[model samples]
Target chain A: MDLAILGAGAVGRSVADLADDYGHRVVALADSTHAAVAEEGIEADAALGRKEAGDPLGSHEPEAVFDAPYDALVEATPTTLGDAEPGFSHVERALADDRHVVLANKGPVAERYDELRELEAASAGSVRFEATVGGAIPVLSTIEDCTPESVTAVRGVLNGTANFILTRMAAEGLDYDHVLAEAQDLGVAEADPTFDVDGTDAALKFVILANVLGGGGFSLADATVDGIQDVPGSALELASEDGRTIRLIGEATREGVRVGPRLVPENGALAVTGTRNIVQIETREAGSLHNSGRGAGGPETATAVLADVGRLD
Target chain B: MDLAILGAGAVGRSVADLADDYGHRVVALADSTHAAVAEEGIEADAALGRKEAGDPLGSHEPEAVFDAPYDALVEATPTTLGDAEPGFSHVERALADDRHVVLANKGPVAERYDELRELEAASAGSVRFEATVGGAIPVLSTIEDCTPESVTAVRGVLNGTANFILTRMAAEGLDYDHVLAEAQDLGVAEADPTFDVDGTDAALKFVILANVLGGGGFSLADATVDGIQDVPGSALELASEDGRTIRLIGEATREGVRVGPRLVPENGALAVTGTRNIVQIETREAGSLHNSGRGAGGPETATAVLADVGRLD
Candidate 1:
């Protein structure tokens, strides 16, 4: 299948790697500065070389995406100024041309499920964004198939960066700032990781999930979010004393949703250590199905996109 | 869809109840001694009442199943002695006629994935058994979709009877006999719960999951099985002191497989407390993804079966 990936950053390269592995031809890759088209598909290793050399592969337009036919468009761009900035138009253009969209880009999906739904209806196109929410967890696909049962509750650590920092604080006795600094140095968190640390990243992902599970476009305004920034250092110690751990839990239930750093009893399945992320989706039928692994990172998100591609062909 | 439930056992009723809720017409029921068929559909509630009141749904006959023109057949009878058992022939007969089979009965599928696979190919039928293992955690469905990715490892607490016993043994420092008594009393363990406690139950489920994930059947003998009966009470205390819990982890890796108890660190996702059963499927793409929840009983398994039906439809 011919594919075009928007954004040649970490997520874009990751998708490119999976596409190359699966032997799918990537037709286009667009970054902030330029768009590159390669009918034969860009190699993942070569793309990595370009990134290391301070020049990304999508820095020049190759013109193949415009001329060559493609089946799907994988959106991997970063979130712009507000949420619906340039990425929205990139997705709109692709969807308008009847391309099936598999999104790892959060900005377009997080803000415009409604607009995209309309585009999908207009063109009778398919849009799968399993990577938009739960990395490789398969939460969206399950919810999509199990509709009307209604996933009444969903709770988990949605952001790997905040989870990494919190896990470090609880396990290694590192303070918030110390752990945050360590995370930044290790490239686990952004230089300004406010979206992850303050729970906005998780909240956006949660909104997308809620929409799928609840059977509609649930806006950010409809959900409640709480960040880990206010969690006191002493709370971690107190949890440790009581054989517990403090993990940032983003929970949405029928009896009102809640997102915060929860003092979980250590015996729970989600009491994961290190950088592992866990998501639990509770439906009327499956009760609570808890899934845990990597919640974020370019490679993990790319793996999810590849999973989507696998399901496609 | 017109459905025929071929047993009045716990599994049969579970499937019937859920299928009825989804508005599927369950037209027939068969037990070892009797069979009931109805055009308007055998009401699940009425059948349950008959079973509770000491009536056997009425005298099994060979022609009863053949007479019904149902869309799907739910085989829920006990495992017959071998391949020539009544349930096996019954399932084969149903599939021979092109009926989709949602098997809640392990006896048939455990002994015959290939036979059933052939039958499915011959008749172009669909076979789903989400309740066969881990109630409705969607293990089979998850593994089915995980075909493109190489499943490196399949590990988790597969037996609720063993897990419940182990949890009691780990948390309260109880002996095997004492925990067994508690599990039986609470309906967590059967009167003849030897299959579950001795790890054979988990072994069969492990083989089934391996088959779906890897596209080939794995023998029960291929797995190194160990039961919870040998775990001493003092071992739990010793492990707990170091912040750990003992769980009967059924694991299958590409190199080899082992189905036995493991002393997991307290922070391990598989170190689930209470009667909750957790399974971790390690794939080439998604690194160990852990799913945990209630693994046994009527309601939970029923929920999963219903979800599968919903997805399949």
Candidate 2:
């Protein structure tokens, strides 16, 4: 398969690196200000080298990628809310041009799910966004493989940064500020860290999952969001004494979506520690399915994009 | 889709009950000695009632199911070792006739994977056995969705019977014998709990998973197996002191497959209690992916079969 990748960030480079092993060819590569296109295949090493050295691979505009002869377009751009511009327009153009899309960006799917679905319905190619939710956990594909309309509810520890802070506080008996500082220093938490600690990240992923499970017309605005910032060390100690642990869990049901710090049995499936993410999907016939893995990271998220690329066939 | 179901056991009945909801027509239904056939669609309720009343659904022979018109055949017979007979021949005949096959039985998959693959290769249709391992967890489908050669190892707590016994022993501070009796009384274990308690069941599942991950030519004999029958309560107590729990874990690598009791951190993903099953797949790019759910039970296994049937399209 020939491909064009938008957003030359960590995830895009990772996908370009691993695409060969998965028997895919990159025909176009684009970043914010640079673009490279080749009829045969883009030289991945040269493009990555130029980007690393703060140079452009070519002088073409980003929109020129849509003209490349490629089967799919991989959108790995950083997410933005509201209009979700550039990312949303990129996906719209790709789908309108009859090209498949594999998305690592959460903005387009979480904010414009119904519109995207309508575009897919009018196009010859489909859109897949496994990387938008649980990284490489195959959460969306698992739902696709099961009986449609079987999923009743989805609940999980969806944010690694928040989970890392909460886990550290519980394990080390430290205050939230201490753990947040440690996590930021270790690059587990972002410099701003507001989206993760304030529960917007988890809420965004949950809204995306809610759309995937056919909970149509759900967005971040529909969810009851609460972060872990107010959680104190004393609460963790009290919960530990009761054989429980606190996790920032996001749950999506037919009725609505919710994100909050909930108590899970210390040894239960939902009480994962460190930077791991776990999603428990409740189905009527298949019972409950739990999937856990690296919730974020360039290579991990890229693997999901490539997996979606492979499924385009 | 039209389906022909073998084995009028619990799984078969459950499949029959749920087939309509999945938009499938059961054209034929067969037990060990009786079979029913209808071109339009079999009446699931009447066939089940007849079987319950100790009467055959029809006068057709078991082999007569193959002659009936159907798109797929569901094999849910009891598993047998060595030849993996009846089930093996049932799958072979279906694939040879160019029909899709969905297996809920482990005998054919674990014992004769290579031959079944060859048959599928030669046939117009395909074979799917998601029901053979991990019940409704979508283990095989998840592997298929990722890079085929990226899987490094697979480790899991695969048996519900042994896990139930182990969990009871640890929680109640009781010995294995006491818990074994309790499980048997609750129908969690069969009258002859040799297969599960002796580790044969878990080993079979691991062998099947190994084949699915492209580690073919493996059978129950290839696995290094050990049962949990002799686990002492003192061992549980000692492990608990270190915040660990004992689980019957089965692992498959390129090297080989093994099943035995191993210590896992009490709060880890693999330390699931009661009858839950968890499989962790280690990959090169995706890192580690963990899936957990019910590994057995008529409805759960039937749900897997139905899911595979949906995939036949």
Candidate 3:
């Protein structure tokens, strides 16, 4: 498959390095500021070298990637919440050109699901966003195999940043602030961590799951969100004494989507530690299914993007 | 789609009840002694009634199902090792007739994977065996979505009967015989439980998983098998003190397939209790993926069969 990657971040670079192993060719590469396009495959090694040396990838504008002949567009741009601009426009343009899309960007899928479906209906291509929810866990594709109507509910620990903080606080008996500082030092938490710490990231993932499971027309505004910022060390100690752990769980059901910190049996499937994520699905016929794995990382998320590319019909 | 069912057991009856909901028309059903065929679709409720009343389901011979016109064949017969007869011949005949096969019987898949693949290559239809391994867990389909080449290894708790016995022994501080008797009384184990207690059941499932993940040409003869029959209660108590639990794990790697009792952290992903099953897959780029669900029961296995039927092109 010929590919055009629409971002130059860690995930985009990882995809470039691994695409060859999956029998894919990178024909275009673009960042917000520059773009590189080739009729044949792009010079992936040179482009990666320039980016690593702190040089601009290319001189062409981002829109120039569309002019290249490619079978699919890999949208790996960083996500932005409301209207999901830039990323949304990139997806619409690609779909309109009869090109399939594999997305690592959460903004377009979670925030503009219904509109994207409209574009898919009008275009010759389709879109897949497995990386938007649970990095390489295959959560969305699992749901696809079972079909949405058979599923009753989906619950999971969707955000690794919040999970890391809570796991540390519970295991080390540290307060939230101390643990947040430690996480930031370890690069597990960002300098501005509101999106993860305040539960917005999990909510966005929950909304995306709901859409994939045939519960479309929902967005972050529809979710009842909560975070783990106010959890006390005393509560963690008490829960530990009782052989339980607290995890920030995001759930989607027919009623609505919700995100909050909940108590789970310490030995149960949902009580994963560190930066791991778990998704538990309830179906009327197949009973309950649980999937867990690394929820965030450059190579892990890019692997999901590659898997989606392989899924294209 | 038109279907031909070749069993009158619990799984077959369950499939009959659920097939309509999946948009399938059952054109034939057969037991060891009798068979039923309807061109338009069988009367599932009536056929089930006759079977429940100890009456023959129909006047036709068991071989009569092959003559019926059908698009796919559902092989739900009991499994036999060694030559894997009757079941093996049944599957061969179906594939030879250019019909797809969905198997609940493990004999053809675990024992004759290479032969079955040859038949599939020469046939116009495909073969799906989701019900042969992890019941309703979708283990095979999950590997299909990720592609077997990218997978490094697959590890899982693939049997319910042995898992139930081990879980009971650990929780109640009872010995193996006592728990085995309890499980038998509760209908969780067969009166003659050698296949499950001796790990043959898990070994069969491991062989099937290995074949589905592209590690074909393997069978029970190639596996290093061990059962939980000799597990002592004192060991469980000691392990509990150290916050660990023992689970009967079946693993399939490029080297070989093996089943044995292994220690897992009590709070880890593999430490599932009761009759539940879990499969963990390791990949080169995607990290580790874990899937868990109900791995047994008539309705659950039938649900997996129905899901496979829905997946047919």
Clashes of each: 2, 0, 0
Best by lDDT: 2
Candidate 3 TM-score to native: 0.95
- B101-178 in candidate 1: lDDT tens per residue? 777666666666677777778885577777778875656656655543456777898787887788888777779998
Alpha-carbon runs more than 4 Å astray in model 3: none
Best by TM-score: 2
Cα lDDT, all candidates: 0.73, 0.90, 0.89
Model 1, A197-266: lDDT tens digits are: 8888887887776666555566666667788887777889989899888887887654444567888876
- What alpha-carbon RMSD in Å does predicted model 3 have with respect to the real structure? 2.0
- What TM-scores do the predictions have? 0.89, 0.96, 0.95
Better by TM-score, candidate 3 or 2 = 2
Per-residue CA lDDT of model 3 for B218-262, tens digit only, reads: 988989999998888988889999999888999987778999998
Interface RMSD measured for model 2: 1.5
TM-score of chain A of each: 0.90, 0.98, 0.98
**Interface RMSD (C-alpha) of each candidate?**
2.7, 1.5, 1.9
- Tens-digit lDDT track of model 2 for B194-278: 9999899999988988887774779989999999988899999999999999999999876778999999987777888899999
Evaluated at residue B304, the lDDT of candidate 1 is: 64
